[model samples]
Target: MTQTLTLTWTTVCLLDRLEPDRGVAALVDGVQIALFRTADGLFAIDNRDPVSGAYVLSRGIVGSRDGVPTLASPLHKQVYDLRSGHCLDLPGVAVARHEARCRNGLVEVRLRQEG
Candidate 1:
């Protein structure tokens, strides 16, 4: 038997409020999530930097590496793939990625379940 999973999405902000190639921080369910608006699309990831232990990913530089959207940590400059939350500069390190979308001009985010 297969079970269906339902996700609760939180409305963060208006899509137009987010500038392209920038990021913003939002607290969803007491968890800090960083939302980014890039040329590729909207992405959501943990605001905390695993290596630096700082909630600064939202302020990280938005760029691309090898055609993959990336966010570079402002503290240590660790590059992370925005889609998968995988650290590019440091292997075996990653942040939590959340599902984000735009509905009726509002940006919504669904926290990713972690085991």
Candidate 2:
């Protein structure tokens, strides 16, 4: 059986606005989200760094580690898996991951609805 994820996709920006292997910050559903377009694909995660508590993940470096796309925190260099939001530098710490993609020249991100 195929599994389906229930999510609301919101268009944040145009694909042309983003450069490859770079991150851009966007606000979706009142939450700060960092969007990245790497050689692998587009990925979205919480903008705030779990360690420093600063909203600056958008400035993080993008690279691949062990075949996983990752974003390293600019403030303290805490690396996080872009696909799973798992912190590499420090175990047991992680940022929230989101679904982000480019469609029809536009960037769209998934937002989790509040109860």
Candidate 3:
């Protein structure tokens, strides 16, 4: 049987705090989430680096990979799709992607309930 996932949305900050083409790390309900603003839209992902295992993805560079918005790790240079959290440099490596949106100018993130 497949288990259903439950999410709890929490406000991170004001949407105006996010700068275009940049990433910001926010501790949301004890989880480190990396928020990004690009020309396409806003995205959120796990702040931990799969390779380095550090909370540094928030400082990663925002760019594009084949027209897809991508975030490159500043610590190890691993490219990850901001929307899908796919690691481009290495296979079988990926991070968690979260649902984020602007609700009344406030940044809200849907965090999955931990087991």
Best-matching candidate per lDDT: 1
Clashes of each: 0, 0, 0
- Estimate, for each residue in 17-101, the C-alpha lDDT of model 2 and write its tens digit: 9998888999998999999988889999999999999999999999989999999899989899999899988889999888887
Best by TM-score: 1
lDDT (Cα atoms) of all candidates against the true structure: 0.93, 0.89, 0.89
Worst 10 contiguous positions by lDDT, candidate 3: 1-10
Tens digit of per-residue lDDT, candidate 3, span 2-110: 5547578889989899999989999987889999878888899999999999999999999998898999999989999888888999999998888888889998998
Q: Determine which window of 10 residues in candidate 1 has minimal summed lDDT.
A: 1-10
Mark the regions of model 3 whose C-alpha exceeds 4 Å error after superposition.
1-4, 113-115
C-alpha RMSD of candidate 1: 2.8
lDDT of 1 by residue, 15-81 (tens): 9999999889999988999999999899999999999899999999999999999999999999999
> Candidate 1 local accuracy as lDDT?
0.93
Clashing pairs in 2: none
Better of 2 and 3 by TM-score: 3
Q: Return the TM-score for each candidate structure.
A: 0.93, 0.89, 0.92
Worst 10 residues of 2 by lDDT: 1-10
